[model samples]
Target: MSEALNRNYRLCEEIGRGRFGVVYRCYSLATGDSFAVKSVDKSLIADDSVDRQCLYNEAKVMQLISPNPNVVQIYDVYEDDSHLHIVIELCNNSDLFHQIANQVFSEAEAAAVLAPLMAAIAHCHRRGVAHRDVKPDNILFDEWGRLKLADFGSAECFREGEMMSGVVGTPYYVAPEVVAGREYSEKVDVWSAGVILYIMLAGIPPFYGDTAAEIFEAVLRANLRFPSRIFHSVSPAVKDLLRRMLCKDVSRRFSAEQVLRHPWMTTT
Candidate 1:
């Protein structure tokens, strides 16, 4: 493990852990700056080429999108015998998931958060990248309350006239097209974003079931119920925006650019 700790970074403490890897709070030995280091298990890399490609693709995407403030920056990627380490900006605040689990956000707070989130997604779309996974857990906040879209392990680049088919993303946030096992484009990401927005306003996902099959059925059927009590204070324009974004028809779903122009998103 000592050899895994490169000369430039000193691993401090574990900050997060998941199926892919463990994230550690590390400091740069050169500048003494703090950053989060995500170390992927080398065993996984050797076991699957697709998984390795995913990590490489994520690193490439992060490099391309790092200039945007709403996207997390990947400062470095390195590998030792046992692990692949990725160093990124350290965000002190919790993710949006924890915040929503506590309670739905107020209109102003929701707008503030969604603004940057949409902007980041728009950036990705413009670059031909589809962040197939967009959920509350993947949205992070910094110390100053600025929102950033994180986690690109499931993202892929698509060209015009091209389509991807597969079941991907969290069940509650996946688009109907993906669940139906049909080809889909970036609009699937818009659907997931809509789900995230709905949860932010209502404190829970619109669809829920005991099993994956039931959840997929609900998504395919567009069975979404808005809780008036929780979102009564939300404006009609906002609700309309959510409706458009959550549309089951991929062609009808609001694009990220269109989402930014919705009446509810206007500064006035």
Candidate 2:
């Protein structure tokens, strides 16, 4: 595979790095198009079999949701003796995390961001996919500020009676069920998205602490509150919507499709 790598992609420069791999900006010589190449070093991967299977699973999940305009496209997957390479659509702008870290978003900006994110999540649910990891870092934007959901490495397809036990996802965004090690479903993504929305409007996570345990405790026990100074113009209707979406009871939580039609999301 190493010998054939030069024939496939011409690596440019390092673009990003994550727990699993280093992403590189590359060019496809065959089509003259640019792509983000994620290379997972085999030596760095702790459990070879599980990591390889997860990589293949991620590729499969990407293919399942490829038709979605708000989901990043996975172009190719390959592996060499040294590493596994995944070629993905190159997004020009940075991720939502960077944007939020810079400052609070205006109501119009928040609405614009939420629209595509909701559509992407709805599409995933329609396809029976649950993106277990739905954090600001995974929501990327293009130059036009159009949002695209990225990183399906922690995603899973749920079937009837299927139950997931192990906790997965970023600590601040994880659902209570995940923290409890209880059987959980797709609604967990909705909760994480609600957390993201809260951050967009209030400029901070609803729950936060110095330690993971404290964060989990905050998530389970605290009520939602928005800083008036930061979100002075945000309406009660919007707050109500966030509360519903972030409901501890998964059954009572609003689905992505339902959330898209909520009044706060629809009004001018």
Candidate 3:
């Protein structure tokens, strides 16, 4: 498979890295198109089958959810004795995580970035997919400035009324229910989005600490706050929408569809 891939794609440079491996920007000699190729090291995995299946499952999930404009497309995948290579859409503008870290974002700016993501997430939910990890890094943009939701490694599809139990997600963005180790549903994704929204508007997470444990503790307390130092200029209407989305009460947490129609997202 590795030998065949070279005929189709010429690896240009290392573009980025993911939890699994390093990503390279590749070009198709046949089509003159650019693509991202993630090369996961096979030697790192003691159980090769598990790694293979995990990657295969992620690819399948992306195929099921994609052809929609806002989701990353998995173009092709192949494996060599040394590495497993997955071809994906190349997002030239980097990701939302770096954007949040490097700049200050206004409410309108944040809402504009979030509107497409919420719509994409809603589309995933409608198809029974739970993108359990909805952090800033997973959101990326192409050269055309269209943002797409990337990374389905932590995503899963669940049936109606099904409950999932596992402590999964980035520590800072994880919902309280996941930390509590309770049976949870797709709504946990909404909670993650709330955390992302908070960071987008405030330039920092609502719950934060120097360590992962401290942050987890802050999440468990589930206290939402707006410090005047950061949010003084933020509007009441924006905060109102944030409150609903960030509602620690799972029952009150806004769904992605509900979030789309929220006053903050809809208004000029």
Candidate 4:
């Protein structure tokens, strides 16, 4: 830990762990506010590795897109000879994956959950930032149960009219265009969000397989279906929205802003 960080905050117990770092509960010395600090060991990151680039980009991107209530906020950053420490607001409640594992949500309930996420994605896209990875595991909740989008290790910046090429997302949540190894735009986040909505409503992924390869095959096929047994009660309006979002044709997929304006999203 840097002296500056230690001087201003008292680092406490480990709260979480990730690929390159451990998250610790921390407290601000001056205001006594609670925060989470992700300490990344510099030694673990190779100089030219994508992980290293994303680690640094995560801070820059969070600084750019944060302050939206739905997105996790970054407060401060510190660097030492040994590690890079990023301090951010803490979302005390568990992630959306755990919540989904517990219960399936109705269309109205799922809409309620997805509204803020769509808003967050819209905000990111408008800022020229693409989350790239928008799975349930990255959706967290604060102590008040407000949904918060977390993790930016796979995020990157892009121009308004251009596309980004990289297969950078969880298999089930990745867009078909991405799986096809084609240049893609910010709408990839919408595809992932659409997958999340599907999972929340059906308690299962729209595409599934025994392995990542099979899952990617299913995603490439992009045959979205609401099995009658599971989606008999789900409204057609939401289904239409899902079709627009999860469409295999990247050009036909809904943008994050379009998703927010959809009838299913608006009415709920």
Candidate 5:
């Protein structure tokens, strides 16, 4: 519309859409570089204004973690009376979910995705930001094939040893303590990452069911298993890393920094 084009960025075509709004290919008039822009109407968001507050929190958290290439680049935030425009790095390949949905992810390929993300997660945690959500759909790859972490709407700033209580992540990846409604920390993100890695290798979520409630039940019990038929090809060290990251005990979960230096991350 006129609102978008008049903002000095030319909107090309709609590339994708999510709970927030539509994403489009946009080019900056001043720099001539192209980027992706997400446009969301203020009225079409969530109840209790949680969605709007999440939008603001996402911006604040991203601004705090700027200049990290492993994370999505948020160029600017613009708002009109009707909509909020978030200009961000465009990823032609979209998200990792579709790619993994169609094929198996070899150990190296999984590592390729996890290493930088571990680093990015480390960066977020070091800055006291818990991403809270770390699903495959939020992992994007640029045109050059560099993986970047996206979607921080569920993110929250945390202090060390602080316990946060909230059921706030994709069901399949939610940490056990979170499902149990117990106090939790940034370790929740590691559990989500562990679930992602499991899916990448097993071609299915570790905790899955016919309904969301069943899945939540499985998560509450920390029911995790590597079916021999599925994980038959996986190496022990990689499985060991998964066990550590997916630990039911939040205190035992591997931190992002520990995951980054994990042997499987460095091995072929």
Candidate 6:
């Protein structure tokens, strides 16, 4: 597989790194078109471990939910004795995290960034995939400035009417139910997306803490607030949508589809 990958694409400069692998910029040997390849270290995945399962699940889930404009496209996968390589769309604008970290965001700007994501999540839910992790770091922008959702390593497949367990997600964006270790549905993704919206509009997370434990504690409380200093100019329509998306009660929380239909999302 290594030889095959080398023959098909020339893996070049390191672009990013994660828990088990490093991402490299690669080019198609036949056409010279650029792409990003994530090479996961096979040795780090213990047999029958959650990490091993997630390694394969990432590819499987991405393959299932892609071809949509907002989701990163997976091209090919190869594995050798030491590494597993996944070729995916290259997002040149870094990630949403870095893109917004130093800037102020308006409701219109935030909606532009979030609408496609919510639409993508709605598509995933319709296909039975729950993107257990939905944070700014996992959102990227392609060369055309299209928002692309990347990284399905923490994703899971579930049936409608059924719930999933086992906590999974980044602290700041994890759903309150996930923080409480309770069964959660795909609505968890909605919650995480809501957190991103909060950060975008206010330039800070709704729940905060100095550590993971403190963050989880804050999440469990599920407090939703907007400081007047920052949100005084924000509209009620957008705030209403956020409250629904970030609702502590899963039953009251907006689904991704519902989010797409919200007034703010549809407004010009």
lDDT of 5: 0.87
Candidate 6 residue-wise lDDT, 1-268, digit = tens: 3999999999889999988999999999999999999999988889889999999999999899978888999999999999999999999777899967988788889989998999889989999999999999899998888999889999999999899999899999999999888998999999999999999988889999999999999999988988999999999998999899989999999989999988889993
Best candidate per lDDT, number? 4
Q: Residue-wise lDDT of candidate 5 within 2-54, one digit each (tens)? A: 46455689888999888768899999988889999888877787657878889
**For every model shown, what is its TM-score relative to the native structure?**
0.93, 0.93, 0.93, 0.99, 0.94, 0.97
**Winner by TM-score:** 4
Candidate 3 stretches greater than 4 Å from native: 48-53
Q: Scored by Cα lDDT, where does model 3 land?
A: 0.86
lDDT of 1 by residue, 110-183 (tens): 88888889999999888888999999899998888788899999898888678987677999999988888889
Query: lDDT of each prediction vs. the true structure?
Result: 0.85, 0.85, 0.86, 0.93, 0.87, 0.92
Model 3, 193: alpha-carbon shift in Å? 1.4
Question: What TM value does model 4 have?
Answer: 0.99
Superposition error at 193 for model 5 (Å): 0.5
Model 4 misplacement above 4 A: none
User: Which lDDT value does model 2 have at 247?
Assistant: 92
lDDT of candidate 2? Answer: 0.85
Number of colliding residue pairs in model 6: 0
Off by over 4 Å in 1: 1-5
Query: Against the hidden true structure, what lDDT does model 6 obtain?
Result: 0.92
- Which ten residues in a row are the worst by lDDT in model 1? 1-10
Candidate 3 lDDT, 1-268, residue by residue in tens: 3987898999988988766689889999899999998888867766756555666677778878877889888888887888888888999787998899988888878888888888889999998889888998899999998989988877888898898877778998898989889988898888888888888888889889899999999999988999998889989988888889778888888988999988778893
After superposition, candidate 5 runs with Cα above 4 Å error: 1-5, 46-48
